[model samples]
Target: MMTEQDTEILIVGGGVGGVSAALAALERGRRVVLTEETDWLGGQLTTQLVPSDEHIRVETTGRNASYARFRDLLRSHYRAFYPLTDEAAADPHLNPGAGWVSPVCVEPRVILSVIDGLLRPFVSAGQLTILLETRPVAVATSWDRIDAVTFETADGAEIVVSASVVLDATELGDLLELGGVEHVTGRESREQTGEPSAADTADLLDMQGVTWCFAIDHRDGEDHTIDRPARYEHFRDWRPSQLHGERILGFERAPEHAGDPARAYLLTPNPDDDPFGIDVDHRNMGGAPELWTYRRILARRQFQPGFFASDVTIVNWPMNDYIGGPLFGTPDAAEHRAAAKELSESLLYWLQTEAPRPDGGAGWPGLRLRPDIAGTADGFAKVPYYRESRRILAERTIVEQDFSVEILGDNAAVSYPDSVGVGHYFWIDRHPSTGGHPGGGGRPQPFEIPLGALIPRRVDNLLAAAKNIGTTQITNGSYRLQPVEWSVGEAAGAIASFAVAGATTPRAVRNDERLLAAFQEDLVAHGAQLRWDSALRW
Candidate 1:
């Protein structure tokens, strides 16, 4: 049996984007329902076990208030629970002087608690309904509008949700696929978008590889040898020297502007712990065992005790990431997933058996996979960190021209008149491919989130609220960060509110200056920075 529920706005995907949208809509006094495929609410922050990875300037530069609220909630949670010195709370960024990004280094559990606390109010208010373990399987649409969405739960129960505005914030843009919306999957052709680095043709699923991250704790003088995976012998001999003989961790020359790669390493006693960073010359192997060993350098005795402790988190472990080209085009997606899992298992086995010990010993066979730590039955992350999604073909697709270093200029960046949000990250942490662009790497310039990107060319009642908006293959690298995802989500919520209140479509809100202004004003009131500035401005 199926039942239908109606709301003013329905947000699919209970990740940072979906939660942000739900909060925004609720604040606007609109009826909203947020659904998640998993039991947890916070997507990447909670289930994924990915410690926050925001640009340095997020606190000051990001234009999304919900993101800021998230940060505040994190700080408040830490204050209430952790036994931290007052200094830690006062200096939230961890780095005393670095205002670039607030590096509130925290544990995954703490973040999950905070996210749950933030959503409690809305749950109680009835304005927001959170349906967890619910997967949206279908979308019902008229000629130009979305009428309702149908979701299926783990128990085979189906529920139909109706809303005036549908926000596709799903990690993989699942709704966009179910709704029959036209979208690009893998990578776009170079000729199609004129992106210097675009692929030869448009492969909608030609997305950046997804990582299955996990945490590890190292205890001194313990033997932890996980069974060698079926593919262990292959990877053992197939060392990509770029990552040293260890098969995972390696270093490379920093950009010429940053300084000589050797010089970059000069300031460090332990190359890993040296605050002076190493330019990942080439991270081709997707943080395999070699890469995992490299990260182990950071867990020096000085930074924190337990260099020989019972448990420590080794985050950059080898895990699942679609390896050969785009995952969507792979002949056997399930086979690829199985192979990836084998690769991860192999890395783990290597770490437990062959990895060098602090005392020059061999292996830690006792290393156990902690699903409880990663919030999954498999020790890997709860969800693959999806780097791309079903982007709507919008009236103005945000291309590299809008964010390119050549176009935006050095020291001076462009700000869109219809800016909805802001985000800034390295131009592109491109995954190494056989035919991808080479030597075109450099620092990414600041970028803007225009209202135009949110407006679909033909869709009437839906707006993208995550990485699935209207970015070219090139620009997604920058806009796919956590803060930016929240920004897009916040903007979508505001737009949904406007659409419901004014009885108009997203295109109308974007095309009309008056309506856009009102929406922007509301965003500002909610703590978003709409305008740009020389410092912390994108």
Candidate 2:
């Protein structure tokens, strides 16, 4: 017999946001159903193979306490399991993947393990159901509410889930399209949102590049080179004119100033191995930095002698950024998806065959693809690292003015009275565009996550739980990070649980000040940071 299960909350994507939402709902004694397209639950961290790219101030400012707990659990797990050197074990903040990108950089699997731990108790209690390798096929919307969502499993079996509240936490906001939620995609004109840094014309296909990141390990005398990708030459020689006319490979980068010429560097040199310097000078500055250590998942220096021969780093660099257009939602989705994958594989091929090395050599054959590390046979990530998503047309659309430092001036960020949570990422650092038009970057300030952003103006029982929240094409750049997504999810989950139990819609909660305040207080109690302090004053 076909299965049709009913739940209190249905989260339609088992990514970082969906996982957070599920945890929040489960904690509230709500029966939750969550589905993921991939086997892995952690999206960018695990399946996408993109290590944490966070701000430097995270050490002092910290994130939502729930996320903090997860981070702590990861470190604690490493401390308990790994054979750490005295020096390594002595340090309190142990970065398993001592990558320069983020202080808490670790392998995707390490994070996946911790996430499993977070869900196990709820799973055992029968409050949560995790459907892996499942995807949303159809949605049953009754007037304004999403009544049921049908998903096809890996085994071709169909499972339908009915819920009071549905959360669209899919990576690309897939449910928005499936459920016919009013959403926007790609570049919005400066006229559309009325903030600086937006394009002059709306280009629906002009979204940020998606990187199909892959992890690798280097062993000197080992040649684990796979077959040369089909389009290796295309990516090697193909540098967008937007890149100021330089090859995609090598240290080639377009100058921050558009009129300036292209520049090349093997990697940003950091003799001190200081992460602060890297974050300020290279990472936050965009372009490219020390390629190898940019997102190293496992640094040999972090472990004891002979424990690791070389570091394992994932390449999500300029060369591999698929800037052809928004592939997931557009008409050319399948064709572009294949091209994106080819672009990544081809970049890897180029790295193994023709990349310039500091040692006065071309290509390092020893740089081997580690399929086992990322849990993918081809060594590429299980999914692409999407920097943008189809955002909902909400009660409030966060434009550049709310957070851009240039526009907001000394304030840098504006506060929302109906705030649900808080997130920090200074600046709108947009990556390469699909049309080969590079977008601008500017640092913003710590921003509030307004509850209105999560509430679709038209949808009654649906809430945006991931990058699908109300954000313009420009503002999406900053709000689309790891911590911000978690905050969004946590808030959505909490609000959904409350709405489901209280017999009200997300819209009702936002409109009612008392209910909103109560929900915010509950979020604060459960580790959702609602606002910044005077110390973070811009």
Candidate 3:
């Protein structure tokens, strides 16, 4: 039997975006039903095991108070549970003198707990109903409005949820596909958007591949050789020239800046002394050792009693990302995803059996896949970190010209009159250059969020909250990141609340300046960074 529920807002994908939208909508006194494919919340934080990849400037002392609040939440979690030295807590950069991209190093579980705590209020208030392990299978829509969302649970039980507005926060823009929403699936050719370095024509199939990240811990003097994965031999020899060595785990630049890219060397075992500051040649120990060392450097002391330890997460190894060459043009997408997963598992197997240790040993067979560490049963990210999705064919598609370094260089970055939120992360990463696109990488110019990006051209009650929002191929690269996703999600929630209150639609919110101002005020009240001020610059 199918169940039916009614809410003022329907938020899909329980990730950062979905949760943020739920929180925002709840604050506006609207009823929100939030659903996640997994049992846990905090998509990137909890499930992905990715210690939030925030821009350096989005930390505690950064420009936005909301961003600071998030940092404070992380710090508070550490303070409440883990006893930290005053020196550690008082440091402005969180790590004091340590020059890391993010200020804090937190366990994935802690983040999950914090996110749960944050959402508890709404759940308790009865304004938010959180359905774990529930996925939206179908969207009941009219000609221009979504009437309800149909979700299926783990047991195959279906529930139809009716809402005034629907927010698609799914990792891969699942709703956009199920709802028959107009969207772009793969890459757009450079010619379509006139992006200076776009490929000659669009290739909807050439999407950025996803990664299945996992954490590893090292113990000293233990032979942790699990077993060589079935496909281990193939990956052993798999080296893309971009890696600069035989190891695929090493660093490379963004595709746009292929020449003279910043280089990152692999980590090797230094038993006698700490090789903390020393730079050495021939450091590439294939790919396995470097992957372990990358994690070790983050928290050397965490693996006490062992000579050295780390919470090493493999991001760019051969196991995941199934794009490029024949794989890119494959007709069977599911097969590609399966192949990618197998590849990642193979990489994991090699790391456990053949990876070099600091004690000059081979294979840390003791390497365990920490599902508890990642807050999921799969020992991988709860959901694949989707880089691109079916973006809506919005009325006002934001193009690269609006935020290009060559065009807006040294000028005030494009500030949308209907700016919803603020974000700053490098442009699209790890995607291949197709369709005659320039094969290089460069720093992305700062960009803004316009109301049109959140509003569908014809959809009356649906809004995109993450990478699924309306954007050209070139522009999606710049806007798809953790902070920006939050911004989009936040805006979607605010807009939903405004529409419900005014008995209007998204288009009305964009067309009415007074209503837009009210919405902006509501955003400010909820700790969102919507506008830029010179004095508030980071």
On lDDT, the candidate that comes out on top is: 2
Lowest summed-lDDT stretch of 10 residues in model 1? 262-271
Residue 202 shift from truth in candidate 2, angstroms: 1.0
CA lDDT of 30 in candidate 3? 92
lDDT (C-alpha) at residue 377 in model 1 = 72
- Compared with the true structure, model 2 gives a TM-score of 0.95
Q: How are the candidates ranked when ordered by lDDT, highest leading?
A: 2, 3, 1
Best by TM-score: 2
Question: In candidate 3, which residue ranges exceed 4 Å CA deviation?
Answer: 60-64, 92-99, 239-264, 268-320, 324-331, 352-367, 426-430, 433-440, 534-538
TM-score of 1: 0.84
Model 3 CA lDDT for position 175: 79
lDDT score, candidate 3, position 13: 88
* TM-score, predicted candidate 3 vs. hidden true structure: 0.85
Instruction: Give lDDT for model 2.
Output: 0.81
The TM-score ranking, best first, is 2, 3, 1
**lDDT per residue as tens, model 2, 146-233:** 9999999999999999999999999999888988989999888888888777778988788888988988887777677779878777
Can you give the lDDT of residue 384 in candidate 3?
59
Tens digits of per-residue lDDT for model 1, 1-538: 7878999999999887887888788888998899999888777666665555566566566546667777777667655654444454455543211111225444566667877777788888887888999998888899988999999988999999998999998877787778888777666787888866566777554455555566565544565556667777875554432222323321222233344333111111122332223223222222222333233312232223432233334344322333434434347666655655566666677667765565676566666676666767767666655556677787777766665765555654567888887777644544433233322323456667887787777888888888788887677777767778788888889889989999998889777888878878888888776665656422
Off by over 4 Å in 1: 85-90, 95-102, 199-201, 237-311, 317-321, 325-331, 356-361, 364-368, 406-408, 433-441, 535-538
